[model samples]
Target: MSGSWAGGRFGERGECLLAPNPGIMTLDGTNTWVLREPGSSTAVVVDPGPVEDGHLERLDEETGDVGLVLLTHHHLDHSEVAATFAARKGCAVRALDPAHCVGADPLADDEVLSVGGLSLRVVATPGHTADSVSFLLPTERVLLSGDMVLGRGTTVVAHPDGRLGPYFDSIERMRSLATAGEVATIWPAHGPVHDDAGAVLDHYLAHRRDRLAQVAAAVERLRDEGATPTPRAVVEVVYADVDEILWGAAELSVRAQLEYLAERAS
Candidate 1:
């Protein structure tokens, strides 16, 4: 909250603004983005962050006239305040899910949504959440990656709603965009902005592959040591370097890893 709201220009047709909401679960706060059409005053707001009063007020103050409020997913941290904020701005809340969506317009994969002369191409990026999506601003070659890719660390594939194979596939999809030079920058839902879209995508892909390998190794080690292959035991051995506080989250990852291994073996 101390730093001034940072805004930057993306190519000729788009502008990106970041509102950092630092705290638990939010990492360096959620990155609330405002993408506007060049030379236009109206803008589209993405992932308004948590429903904190201050954050909402700051969003209103920063984005003078919002043409739309779009949620990348239905997570509370991202869309909890969508209804209130959309009502305040007299804009409709567009999302993939109806439960969290303020209006009836459900976002479709490959859908082109426009506001104020700027358009965002929706890319279905499930596995972070079933409803998770990434927005591609083709004109600027910038992607609003929601929780699919984080500026730092890997995103949790919150299971039940998230899965490993699909998550890997989603990363590959983003990687294709970067490799094709269709995306140059990543405006993630959390943490700082990333300019090296291709490199970031590569890193995310590598990280997940390495993690799967590590999980497999950990399971093998447990077998070698005659340790029970329970989820808790695997988490303890595999995530020993991770903070104890995050073990719960690690356990979820371990579960996903186990499922992956099980499926592969079958």
Candidate 2:
């Protein structure tokens, strides 16, 4: 069902449940997902979302017994409630980063975790964060993509914690999985569920490439105009069409791109 606090389910094999946590940094809101095997009693919880009490209560109501709490990344919005939720359910919270994990085990790539006979394969998808990962549910051909891919708009590279090259590689990796028919839908951390996994992944990859090209063009434009080719000036030109609110974020991406370009030039 769709509502202000919750979203509908998708696919016959598993549900694409959502717990919306709308806020400033969250854009619309963070999505806490519940994925269960068809006709199973236990379910796997992905990204427990923020520490909102109401959300935790809703989670309790939605999932009676959680088998595991799997985190895609360590972003606050996605991982803030993991510890609490895991404690409440007496389940383990698994993540790639040990720091973000409470008492649960650290997740590893290629590991297959089973909950109520349903298995999930972990895929390391860093770049959104050094510890980012995606879960592949083969039975449903569904991928639970965390911050690596969003439902609404593009995700920030999150510089310092996130990088451009690895981000591109992660997208391509997801695309390859989709191309292989390993993924039919994407259950992202934010926004609605996506049915066209392959096309969406392709679009995400192409968009990043296009943005890099735009950054290059912006650098060229500034040089032609005789403006200083510093990161700040480059940001002004490359992100001219972007809102001031997002320019700061754009600048980070620009800086990352500039660094990549500089390294390549050398």
Candidate 3:
């Protein structure tokens, strides 16, 4: 809330319209991206954010003649207005989850979508959620990372639906893109844009490693004291510095970590 994440135009084909929802979890708000190729009449819109009257009105005005609507994930914050907005624009909504799509097939891994002279490569990055995915604009060298990568801090690996193992694989896949110079900038769904994709991805990986180590140590210490390592208990020890308001989110991540540890042990 201290920092400004007022979304704006970036690269050659993308413009961000920041939503009104701001909170502890949603850094500033969801980034509703309007992507159009230069001189193209039709464009593609991504993650049409929450159902706010003003935000939707602004989006309707900014995004003239939308060719298609793309979703980073099925999170309500990002997809609440996707169908409605797509309906208004007379376009189809597409996501990794078919349930989220309207009048379009579910997005396939490594699928290349060409619309309005712009090309986007769909990269399956299901870690934050089972249906999570990222879009790679090879021409712009930009990655539209949904909740998988945030502009401010590390993203949470929600338990049950979100697994640490898949999250690790997703991060490594993104890192490979950055390291290969295929992706230079990260246009995250929340918070501000990142210039150096490689640096940010490295930080995300390192932070997750540190947290995993801390969780392991906390679990071991608890077991030594003849205590059961519950998710809340693990969170209390590992995320002692984090705000209490975020304990719920922290606990979700702890559950994922515990499951990951169990899997590794097996």
Clash count, candidate 3: 0
Candidate 1 Cα misplacement greater than 4 A, ranges: 1-20
The sequence of per-residue lDDT tens digits that candidate 3 reaches over residues 204-257 is 999999999999999999999999989998888888998999999988888998
Quantify how close model 1 is to the true structure by its C-alpha RMSD in Å. Answer: 2.8
RMSD per prediction, one decimal?
Answer: 2.8, 2.6, 1.2
lDDT of 3: 0.92
RMSD of 2: 2.6
As for TM-score, the candidate ahead, 2 or 3, is 3
**Which of candidates 1 and 3 reaches a greater TM-score?**
3
TM-score rank, highest first? 3, 2, 1
TM-score of 2: 0.91
Worst 10 residues of 1 by lDDT: 1-10
Error of 1 at 229 (Å): 1.5
Q: Which candidate leads in TM-score?
A: 3
lDDT of 2 by residue, 4-105 (tens): 334567765555445556754465577777878888889898998886658888887778888899899998888888898889999889999888776777
